[model samples]
Target chain A: MTVELASIEGQRPDGQEREQDLSKSPLSIRGLTVTYGEKPAVFSVDMTVQPGQMTAIIGPNGAGKSTMLKAALGIVPPVSGRVQVFGRPLEEQRARIAYVPQRASVDWDFPTRVIDVVLMGLYRELGLLSRIRGEHKARAQECLERVGMADFAERQIGQLSGGQQQRVFLARALAQGADLYLLDEPFAGVDAATEKAIISVLKSLRAAGKTVVVVHHDLATVAEYFDNVFLINTRRVAEGPVAEAFTEATLQAAYGGRLATTQVSQLAHKA
Target chain B: MSGEEFVPLSLTPLLIGVFAAVACALPGNFLLLRRQALIGDAISHVVLPGIVVAFLISGAISAGPMMLGAAGAAVVAVVLIEAIRRLGRIEPGAAMGVVFTTMFAGGVLLLEQTDTSTVHLDVEHALYGNLESLIWLDAIGWSSLLDAEALSNLPVELPRMALTLVGVCLFIAVFWRALKISTFDEGFARTMGIRTNALGLGLVITAAVAAVAAFDAVGSIIVIAMFICPPAAARMMTNRLEAQIGWSVGFAVIAAVVGYVLAGYGPLWLGQQDAVSAAGMIATISGLILALAAVFGPCRSRAGAPAGV
Candidate 1:
């Protein structure tokens, strides 16, 4: 189920190519760079996320994986670059994309129930002056059920376990009704069962022709879960089919001295 | 201490406390949810200078000018905090501390320069409000036919403070779900197209309006007590946002009544020469309630502490 880096080169399935239709480019990035004040986190990253694909951006710690995702969403203003979603600029297409920030980024103890959190995904559709109506509540409940969280709708978000919280977030994303989904470290703290649940949802999203871009840490599951992979450090290490682009050489380049080349090569061979 | 002395339906303080409690609690819920609880304290304190400056310019403590001054100062405090956070690379607490302390000090200095004997900017008076005086204040006139009848009878007119508080509370009640969603998960809110920033600013403005309404009755220092205490206490007793709001209003009304009655009768009952201030007593009671909640409230789960932990 794994993809070896060396075998991926030219064998990238035609289905995996970035959709050629200009009208279908769900996300486009050109020379995107993100810096924290003075320190550069992601430098010169170029990527195009197209419809009907699961794009996993993979890298070692401090490789700017999350930064690239944030930059693409305009959450972090890129130092120098442009990002477009569905041929429109980020702000123009904000409603068409949903973002799930790292779970750690928010305050868990905040006084909000799971249903309330899920209803947040309906805000853009509902607008500010309007309230969440009966239909919105029904939709929220349906989304919660999709993620196996319907029973927990009335529970406070802080009361949920880690895996349950992750499911709740996924449910919120499901309720967003966006064309593009951006998830930062969705699998970081989850159990194997939770991972399976997440993968199934992502697969369904791709099956439905939506675009999914995830910041992933686990190399073993990349090929099994994603159609394409973007290997990144401070710069674009490589990007293509999971089998060809995610090689020992690319992993070494992206991870630097942290991961041994032989270990990556073996993992690639095993794929 | 006869039962006759305690009128459950007293028109003045009861109505005033009910309105004020609802208004303050509505915005207070958002503030607590946003973890910006202390911003209320900062705005209340900084507005002192704005009030003094407005009084000096207008030569009178008109409600309109004083409210504008206080709101302007609140905006200034927010801007200052934002600037300090940006320029100094300081934490939010540090930034808020710098802004509130500087503005409060400036207000005190300005008050000292004015004719203190005639234009008294008493710190004690500002911190806790004189709720008893609100009973003597004129009632506001509403344009409706029913309101005209209510006004013509001079039937123990509802104090202006109570009306203002009730209006604000109604606004919060109407937007309760939106505020809760925005406060809890802003990123999701933005994605859902909630105009998260506008909602955030609205919450801040609501806090400012509540603080201003409370300033004349409770004084600036203790206004924060009303803004924070009821919400804090309610947080412990409920998991639902609606329940929290209800509990906060309930707690606030109870505290106000007990504080008012105790301050009015404490000296006579204890045979003490000095009577306690009602505003001071209200704030003290609120603080006690908050303290009790903090100590006895169910402990928040420590599992899955964020990455940096």
Candidate 2:
């Protein structure tokens, strides 16, 4: 089903005001090449994520969208590239960047509670071995409430549904108090209601002037959900405003022959 | 033995067992949580070669030389495991199996060359241990603790195990937050400047030390059992890290006390005169406790706990 594009800044009407500011973009990757053993996952990809916007990195399966994000977060060491957050190297600007790995990356059955996971966001703020005072607990509860998980704070993480798990992760990112959030496949396996909630949260994040870069797969809602779209296969194909840059031609280039069938089905359904 | 004579003998072994149990189980929780429980088993096996080699070089069976050798062997064992994991491209479990078995075999071969006829250095002592033999007989009564001569006769194992447990408690206390965060999520902890690699390496080293410290009193089997079982059982009881650790230590101490008494009296209960090996009994009790927890503990349904979150 088509999603509502009314709230999304699909094309910047005040284009002059949104001029490319390399120093101000929340995230910028230059010549980022990530290799897995002998094979390259992402090759010399260069992209910038503007602040105060929701950017979607979209492509087919095995398109290195997650790899690019992992490289930028330093989870996977880039073979050759530099990642900058707010015009500084990732290491220098680490405090301002928050990353949410794939929901499947962590063990859901780990012996930990919902509050413990959220409190991890405050590890840097609390420092080592210091007691988590009431103020810190209050902040974590506030973040959990933002994602509608305040009621489930005491539940074991494994008890949560996939959508609830996604919300918990989003709450954790909110607790991080970072200027930029990088989410990898957050919408995967989530219910429609969770998707709406997540989008609303993303909209709020943008409203608060925080940047969010999400690795998304559903091409139908890319324009509707995000202000900017970055299209890639192994290499970056195109990137900019969704209306201008996310064309059928670019989708075909990113997905090869797979896009043509999907386009035809959409056209058939529309007719 | 009369009840009067049983007092001092039981107290010393009981204390030693408690110390060993507490020491091993403290770090055991972290090891189990980190999905490196086998490393405790590996370190225990690998330290045998170190202790044997140190005996050959120092030509003495003193604690200092033995500790040095055990520490050296434990470090080398970890390095070899990592080397095999990275260079040999082997999975961690297989690599641990390869290094520990080989090093332990080498230790056995070396032990054959050295004279192990002495009670303290006997090969049997390495496996079964001699908790019953650790009696402070000279300390005739509680007042003997005030007598320097009587106190001097106390088994070194008692003090050594006690000190190790104290040290482990302090280490876990001081680094609680770092350990919890790093164990929960290493990559994110790294991004938060946790020095995750150093914290992880430090944890492995601490486990090695605990295994080595408990090695002489409880033997490797008991050390391995204490390392895995109490923590595994405790994990089945609670989801909070602090509570899990507390439960693990509590379970460990309980197992130690009950196991020591059972080792001494279980045969009597069976209408036999001979007591069982205290180390074997301790390990067996730990297994029983684990089974009980798995069946009836609050979090038993989530027992698998899934390695590497």
Candidate 3:
């Protein structure tokens, strides 16, 4: 696997108009496939995510948006494909990325402070058995402040609101110090204020030259929030600039048979 | 021996109690964190038949075979719990209740059918052992110069109870971080490159070892208490992982000493019925601690709040 990844890096085709550089492809997926038992959750797909860009993957329910993100991060293994990060294989480059799972995916009643959750972003860096140092705490506090959650740093995680929890998770991701961030359904169930905070954070991350890929459910917010969009339905339908890839036709392809064309058309108009 | 006779404080029970508390609390942290609080109860009960079957086969109380049997039985309980979820459409708690109780009942019936004289499988005794009666057996070996003079020659073959506890605790401490991550958010842990399956299996193994340890000290009935009460109490007191662990160890150790002392003195003071079983008393204390925490601990009203709003 290392050799294959090394070869791919060594054999980067010249003159391909590298968006960033061969050395800065934060995430790259080729012919990625994911299956749950015999059912294909995500079909063969290929894409490259450039650093310093806010990319949103938009699709209806069960369109494999989350699966693609997970598979790319090696959370869920791809049936057959290659996922490269920072010119290295996913395993070798784990510390270079952070993942924010869906807020609803965890038990809220777990007894942990907000700061502790954020400090988890440093786990890969600190490795197991290492204590959280003063510097780690300072960084965590900084991340919380960036998210307007500094005051709540000492709050029990279960005591926070949905938006607060989401910010805490984002803060953890920020504390990770990774070049790539993969977030799943981050905006789901969040208030408008929280949504704006998250978007601003994403923008700042992009401004800092970090790659951000989010599994977004709000179709209307896609064009406004993200610079690039990937429309998915078990497979990649289209991926490019938000304006070019998020048209009515692509929406039709991604949400076929599940959403009414009239409703999607209305959504497209809103977008 | 008269009630006034001094047995003197021995290191055996203390070491056993400390080791068991540490071992059980280590994995119990994960179980409590995962919200699978009743899993310990389920595993302990399920191990009953495994112990009986092992005894029937070996005709001796050997730690190795009994541990293997208990581990096997615990695995079966997990499988049954999953099966019930898949096939019976039952909630996990109900499935565990069904599996454990039935297995425990079957184990009792099987034990009754066997030789009553040679096999001393008294349910009450199993639930709470007479720690006072545990003879100060010979120490197993190698004492250093720093060791207390009296304890230097003490038997090292830690009572079956203490050895099991130390072994289980060591295992948990070694896998602390992995277990913590897995218990908190299995999906996220997996995404972060931690093997959730391996961590989960390790938790199960720890649970089995805890059960075996409890089998000799407090017995299977009260083992559930050791597995649960300390962690639950600790949960209410702190949010930091290290603090939680520290509180759990502190609570367990206190319960062990208090329970042991009560068992020794309460019988003479009351002068009638047998004093409450030390294990049961300790479990009761743990329960009381949990109750206090539930009532007085900070309320978790912010749970289920939306994120990134």
Candidate 4:
């Protein structure tokens, strides 16, 4: 039913590459609807992220923010949607993208070194028997140092602080050498220093013309951290520049009664 | 234990026990980390029907056909467990319990109905293997280890288990990074374009191969024990995966040797008339090792109240 409307921006091109220019938006989704059993998670959600922009996907908890991102990435099955990256299907541009998942999604007790976690970013080039060569280690080390975690290379991953763990994940994404980065709650449950370090790394990525999209929670940090905001609550609400789309009306619409009036107003005024 | 006396009777079973334990323990490390340790128990339990069906089909107790049967059974059990879990909407542990137990029961009943007057295929043999009987009658002494003819007469289970261990080791070595990543964080592995589902299936299948091979040699008792106890105990010892695997292999070898010697001679030392089952003792020893590690291993606790918290 929404296919006709989604056709306005063009259908998600089949797996084949389109002749469109490479300057197309880094990510674009049309008519995306996802459901788990009978309950809909995201419905008819359409979002587009322009190149070189820092965008935040914000919604109240359980508003399908993560699901929408996952569906767009083909991590989760979407009922009806087309997702494209750089004017081509996502699979085609995988080498140019890096994804930093949430900190809590993995078992922290896994027996691995901090450096090895960062080296996974270079997995694209690894072969069955290919050893982790000197160059790969150097790159991983550089990424770690970039995140200010240079001294904890040999430590067990389980022994690290949550903020340190999050830095390791970012370091991994940095090691990917990706043109586009997608992060899920990179700032959640981290110390202030960790938050500042992550934001700066992302800002550097933005300055280098790499598109970055984050699934964010803190409304207060929205205007400071991201250049654009995509507010979604089960469906697309408002999206655009932080100063324009992030208003009291949009915050109310996205948060609904779940957020107190004062909190929304405070966030809107803060933005 | 003199070499002349030990060469023919105890050598083959001891070597087979060690090989089987190490083979299962290698893959067991990843399974333990993945929290799929029960898959080993599941695979070991389900091996009974596989072996029984193979014996019935071939009308013999040969290794090849019995192995094939066991492999087929393991696959069936995995698929059925998955199906029940999905269709019935039950938890995975419950689904595994249901499928493995039902298949194991069916196997026990099948063993009862079959005619076994001439062969050694019985419920007791399947449950607790005849390890003492797998002797090297042709081995005259330690020199027999160097003799080609004597070597040829060695128990087939030895070579088979050695090959299985190598295969498991190779699989782990080749896919070590992927396994570690997928086991720790499946979503991130998938996002990195690794086929997590296929890799997971590959891992389960590898575990099944180890379980089936070890089950054939030493029975399901040791299979279940080796698949969990050694790796779990090793987990308490080290926080490094490389070190953990090293510790697991060491523990497995120790359990096999110590358990076999005790089973063979502990009875005489205690003034008993008969020897105990080497399989039972080996399992018990591994369990004891796990208990000890749980109490005193350096990394026994969960990494200092989890700094991440």
What lDDT is reached at residue B126 by model 1?
A: 64
Instruction: Pick the winner on TM-score between candidates 2 and 3.
Output: 2
Residue B259 of model 3 has an lDDT of: 67
Please provide, for model 4 over B1-309, each residue's C-alpha lDDT reduced to its tens digit, 9 standing for 90 to 100: 688879999999999999999999998998999888988888877878888889888998777887799888877987998999999999988998898899999998998998865676787777667788889999888999999999999988889888988999899998988887788778777777778889989998888888877777788889899999999999999998889999999999999999999998999999999999999999999999999999999998776355465
Question: TM per model?
Answer: 0.84, 0.89, 0.85, 0.92
lDDT of 1 by residue, B1-309 (tens): 322232222345545655665567668877887888876787787788888778888887667888888877877887999999999999988998888889888887877777645533465556665556544222332222235553454323235565677667666766665676767766655544456687788777777777777776567645678789999888887776777888788888877877777777778789987668777777778788778877776633333355566
Number of backbone collisions per candidate, in order?
16, 0, 18, 0
Off by over 4 Å in 2: A1-23, A261-271, B1-7, B74-92, B146-149, B303-309
- The chain B TM-scores of all candidates, as shown, are 0.82, 0.91, 0.81, 0.94
User: Which pairs of residues have clashing backbones in candidate 2?
Assistant: none
Highest-scoring model, lDDT: 4
DockQ of 1: 0.35
Q: Residue by residue across A1-271, what tens digits does model 4's lDDT show?
A: 2333444567553333232333578899999999998999999999989888899999999889999988887778889999988766888777778989999988888888899999888888784568889999999999999999999999988888899999999999999998789999999999999999999999999999899999999998998888999999999999999988999999999988888899888888878
Q: Per-prediction RMSD in angstroms?
A: 7.0, 6.7, 4.8, 4.4
Global fold similarity of model 4 (TM-score): 0.92
Give interface RMSD for all predictions: 3.1, 2.5, 2.4, 1.6
Docking class of 2: acceptable
The per-model DockQ list reads 0.35, 0.34, 0.52, 0.53
Weakest lDDT window of 10 consecutive positions for candidate 1 chain B: B1-10
Query: Which residue pairs clash in candidate 4?
Result: none
lDDT of 2 by residue, A26-136 (tens): 888999999998999999999989778999998889889998988888877889998887655677667777777778877676778888899889877787667899998
User: Which stretches in model 3 have alpha-carbon errors above 4 Å?
Assistant: A1-25, A77-80, A257-263, A266-271, B1-18, B75-99, B130-132, B137-165, B271-273, B298-309
